[model samples]
Target: MTETHVPEKLKAPVLGAVITVSDRCSRGEAEDRSGPLALARLAEFGVEVAHPVVVPDDIDYIRSALQEALDAGARVIVTTGGTGITPRDNTPEATEPFIALSLDGLAQQIRLAGLAATPLATLSRGLVGVSARGDRGALIVNAPGSTGGVEDALAIIGPLIGHILGQLSGRTHEVESADE
Candidate 1:
């Protein structure tokens, strides 16, 4: 597998978490493929990923999972599933309340990249943003449930994790200088 390069400025491995939002998976009637894929992808970028959690496609459950990840010290949390147009697709809505700064460009980039693979990507309502709760907030992103969707989202964010985290921890100047 082709691995995304971890930026040199990243002095340490970043902590990450993955949440799979699918009723069937949560009910144990179906396997959760997206969550594992997300975890592996995050690990490929040198992220220390926490064990993934599976949740039903409910806003409350999704929100709780987000809080759980945050409480567990996850610096980046990726929720795979519930990003489609279906009635159960509530990842974006669940994640919105936690966002202190919206990363519209990153969200758009994921969609734009996905469009190259499938036109249905346009229907995805995934979101990307930062949840500024403590001295350092976690970066939260909502990705579709499909394996392809998870790949697309990770491919876009993998290389930028360090820089984004740096910005979150008030190291914007240092991160910027490294880019120069």
Candidate 2:
């Protein structure tokens, strides 16, 4: 068999934003743990997180926040909360119009990982997608609102960050083995 080699593309370090969607949190009635949790997790990967925001669980509000983050040069927007099976949960619906592609596998993996910790994970309506904005072309992903859910989702996505960035920058290569 012939060996195949692919060059890796260089991508600039991109900015990110963490948006926590909860009515109480937006109203300053409850602490916003999910947003902070997401920021900390992303920081571990050396990603710069811009200002995080707490918004009510409203579709229009979430949509506006996403647009603002993208306009502010955030290449990745991770939203926590409003991804449940409730009447007020409208994250997926709000984000649908902004996505260029839906990353079902990522969301599925998150759900599966969350399931290991709680059966309620099956009810999570988290989603992942690429934003439709022409300039930013960012990847927008929605994860569960709880701290544990945020942790699990990031754990699942952590290993793929480099590859995703490579892909976004128009490079494809076989990831080097850990033993190497």
The clash count for each model shown is 0, 0
Backbone collision tally, model 1: 0
lDDT agreement of model 2 with the native: 0.83
The sequence of per-residue lDDT tens digits that candidate 2 reaches over residues 100-120 is 888899999999999889999
Candidate 1 accuracy as lDDT = 0.87
lDDT of 1 by residue, 1-180 (tens): 334444544677878899999999999999899889999988877788867899999999999999988888889899999999888899999999989999999999999989999999989999999999444699898988999999999999888887788777776442233335
Cα error, residue 27 of model 1, in Å, equals 1.2
TM-score of structure candidate 2: 0.87
Every model's TM-score: 0.89, 0.87
Worst 10 residues of 2 by lDDT: 1-10
Q: Give candidate 2 regions above 4 Å deviation.
A: 1-12, 132-135, 174-180
Which ten residues in a row are the worst by lDDT in model 1? 171-180
**Mind sharing the TM-score for model 1?**
0.89
Residue pairs in candidate 2 whose N, alpha carbon or C atoms collide under 3 angstroms: none
- Residue 56, model 1: lDDT of 97
